[model samples]
Target: MRLATIHADEGTQAVGVDLSQDEPRFVRLRDEDLGSRPSMIDILSEPDGLHRAESAFNAGRAAGDFVEGRLAAPVPLPGKVLCIGLNYRDHAVETGAEIPSEPVCFVKFSSCVIGPGDPIVLPRVSSKVDFEAELVVVIGKRGKHISKESAFEHVAGYTIGHDVSARDWQKGRPGGQWTLGKNPDSFAPLGPYLVTPDEVGDPHALDVTLSLNGQTMQSGSTKEFIFGIDELIAHVSQLITLEPGDVIFTGTPPGVGDARTPPVYLQGGDHVEISIDDLGTLSNPVVAEPD
Candidate 1:
């Protein structure tokens, strides 16, 4: 079942999406429905939380009080927003980086997250902002030293992620400030929906694409991943613990702006859309940081 978080009169609410229809319908889940789980993170913390959510979704669908609320990041305040770099062979080749034997991990603080339809604020401090379309893995269960074989068991679902970057700070700086370059407000745009693993078969085989102002800028597939989800989870979990509502951006494909012929960076009024097959598209507008 597809799940989402949306702004309601009461506050942010966890919802289930009915995609069976042409236009998706949203069903607001009651607190009791999710066993008093107040947020998406709380729901996923329970082993059978998704199952309970699924049942709630089905019941709500039948009753038909479908909501029309503004969307919010599926997990608005993820405990951790881990990301992988150069995890795609083609992206690695494009950047002229050596294929690493293990996953190259990084962190994007939760403050960077914005939901679909939100604006990606082009910070005044950086002029070389670039886009990276990625497939995000939403962790369901908490575990450390997770095995690749059992990695899928800990996965709640998947979503699309836009890993916006500031090239000057990321690479042009004295010591390469990746964290500073990447953690700008609204730099991490996630969601439209958080689709369950059962609904998104073969996460490593989806088509990943990004378009800037209606022009396709990045196009590739998860099949090009150097370190797949299982490998990434197992690799990261060896040290840091993986918890519910923590998300891992599995990395972007080839055709990043930094590797382009002339380097196309984001500008004010530009629209960005990142689409991953089965996970749906995440679209955000580009805006300048206010004066």
Candidate 2:
């Protein structure tokens, strides 16, 4: 079952999505058990959250209609937003960076997150903002020192992620301010829905692509990943504890704007759309930060 967080009269509520019919239907998960105005994290953190959500979704009560501008990030305030860089062999080749034996990880704070239909504000300080399409893994269960063999046990599902970057701050600064370059407001656009693992078979076999305006800029497969999901989980858990709602952006493929001959950076009035095989498309418009 697919899940999402949406704005309602009661406030932000977690919802289960039904796509069986011609038009998609949404049912609010009876999360009264979770407390007032529970977020997606609160629901998924419960031991039988998904099961309860599934039961509620199948109850066939009045289905709620999606309100315009009501969809929010599935895990709006994730405790941690971990990102992997250069985990794709093709991506590394395009950037002319060496393939590392260990996973290259980074963090994007919650302040950077936004949902579908949101505008990606192009910061005035940076002139080389770029886009990356990535497949995000959402953790369902908490675990420390999770093994590669047991990694799937911790997975809740998957979602599409857009890792927006400001190349000038990311690499041109005094010492390369990765966090500053990456953590700008609305830099991480995630959601549409958080699809269950059962619905997204073999995450590593999916096709990922990103388009700017109407042209495809990046296209590649997870099959080119140098460090797969299981390995990434096992590698990171050895140090940091994995909690429910924590997400890992599994890196982007080649064809990044920075690698193009006359690098194509984002400008005002551009639309960015990212799509994965089973996961849905995450689209956002770009606007210049007001003076």
Tens-digit lDDT track of model 2 for 68-108 = 22678889888999999998899999899999989999999
**Tens digit per residue, CA lDDT, model 1, 34-80:** 75536899789878889888888888889896888888899999999
Give candidate 1's whole-model lDDT: 0.92
lDDT of each: 0.92, 0.89
| Candidate 2 weakest lDDT stretch, 10 residues | 60-69
Best by TM-score: 1
- Give each prediction's root-mean-square deviation over alpha carbons: 1.0, 1.6
Q: Lowest-lDDT window of 10 residues in candidate 1? A: 29-38
